[model samples]
Target: MNLALAAAALAGTPNDSHGESISQGVDSKHILVSQAQDWVAEDRQLQKSTIEVAPSDRRLIIPVCNTAFEFNYPFASSQKTLRAVCPSSGWQIFLGISVHQSDNALRYTGNFKAGHQLTGTDVELASLSSAIAGLAGDLRAIEGFSLASAVRAGDLVMQRQLVTPIEGYRLNRAVAAGEIVESSSIDSILIASATLSAGQTVTLEQLDGARAARDLAAGKVLSSYDIKKRHQVLITQSGIPRGHPVTRANIALQDYYGKLPNDSLQNYRSAEQMQAIRNLAAGTMLRLSDLTPIDIIRKGDNVQLSVRAGALEITVTMLALENARLEQRVLLLNPESGEEIQAIATAVGQARGLSTVAR
Candidate 1:
């Protein structure tokens, strides 16, 4: 590549007839001039900006953190996006044409606007300096992840993109120039689960995975409320009467029935069959295909209940005895015989009914 070629290409100034080149002096002065011109061209970075991205893109607005100074009182937020532009270099000084002619790199950087507040936050600041510094760092972080790709959609390009999981992940291990490695490890990740976080710790979440692992009951139909696994069921360690606070999902009544099959209640019709199950407890796992809802019914007995869309004979002990005095369970019995036919246990509702007398 001739050092003078670029000059000749741009300026078709007839080569001095005597072959005396226009670059009679490719000195520091000439290089400096070019450098100045380069700066001039890049002067209005915002104006001269060619969005190196898709023309029509919608950038994802991720809420990095919430700023609240007082407890229970959330800070009022008028969120404004901070934008970052890439200038790549600042004040540059091109010294002596090509260094092949004279080895010298005279590039200097002054002030560059990497980013700006598209919409700015008006935080009640105790200290302006701290806020400003924090904001600068945040701006840089935003800039660091602002990758512009020329994604073409038809004739126009859309420069918008979502912030992917590992978008700004920084790789650690160095591979020699020509190494063909299948994978690379990261030095660390930027963010982790809202519940977990550490500098270099990473959360390897499988997309659409269970928010957290738990027993998946066969008929458990999940809903939006269950989608967020914020409520952690903690069982008591005391090993007394199998009355530990069992971790049963608080499924919606509607969802519970919706999941049950049409013929679920039919399986538990007999008095003897229902009689065998007076010791039902809340948090008890029920599978109507194998479990009965209302156990034990005698002759002339009337089962009291309404069947809804999701009909299931779910046999369950009351969590606490029904209609109690001194928090104790009362017996639902045969008034004539004064014998306990049905028992409503207290606290952790479980069945404690007497055996049916033979006619």
Candidate 2:
């Protein structure tokens, strides 16, 4: 019998006869060749294709498996060989087979360095052998991909060697270390196809209030590590006494570029109603921990208590029961009525009753 018919017969193909006996185990070589043929037919979608298996030891035997055999192509570039494994017996063998080649593949038109962005003119589709056809990815979809490694002219273009482009920000001009990065400093949004060795690139939103952490060249893609948040900290222009309120006269906004202190105050408005917790020297960066809310009224101080009802307002003297900051609720004692009441501190020596007293 011919090699193809013998392989099929050994792999349990039914003969014209009803029943046959005298089974003496299956030949290992025949099983390998049969499985290789099945792999090409099923995986490669080739119908009745001819497959030539290399000859092995004629004495080699493989036990008949109750379950189906498994075949796998181990090489990525070529399907010239396959591994046949018997699941039940754990018997495995490698078999060499012939596979026809006539597939289209993309090849580089000229030598290109790593990071070179691919264009339509850079590659062309050409007929390649099936042994290496798997390395040639979808040729029509490879445009705009960047090369991860250098490739020579006429070399097969591979999917594994390409990187997809991403959108990121690029610098318009060279920025020195410690310089603040503004919106004008960004040239444009870059569609980066090149592999980034320095890490992920930055976005336009990240440039809102950022400063360069190091010297960067023009056209360089900005990474998160390359920039820091630019801070506008409130710094004391003159010595401030403890308990003194932080005002524009004693403090000024200073541009600070670097890592910011966790407690550093950024807005002057926030500091206007705060008092120094301790004596602060000139040029000290104001921090949240170094300041406390200023007291608008002190304990035992006489304050004007205003009560209003239906457009009628009456002011009376009331004694503060506790020191309180603006908008803080404070306990007050009405000297005339000798009654304790809650009022909101409005200003120095001034308190407003919580509810309108109907005259």
Cα deviation at 357, candidate 2, in Å, is 16
The top-ranked prediction according to lDDT is 2
lDDT value, residue 190 of candidate 1: 32
| Sliding window of 10 residues with minimal summed lDDT for model 1 | 64-73
RMSD (Å) of each candidate, 1 decimal: 25.0, 11.6
**Estimated TM-score per prediction?**
0.18, 0.54
For 32-58, candidate 2 gives per-residue lDDT tens digits of 567668777888766535555654544
lDDT of every model, 2 decimals: 0.25, 0.75
Tell me the spans in candidate 1 whose CA falls farther than 4 Å from its real position.
1-142, 146-290, 293-342, 345-359
What's model 2's TM-score?
Answer: 0.54
Q: Residues 1-359, candidate 1, lDDT per residue (tens digit)?
A: 11221111111223344323424323322333343334423532322222121111122111111221111111234111111211222212111111111111111122212111111121111212222211222222332232122222121111232122232223344333222211233333432122122332223231122231232232222222222222122221222122111121321111121123443332122211211122334432233333232223222333232212355543422222133322233444444454443443322223343343332
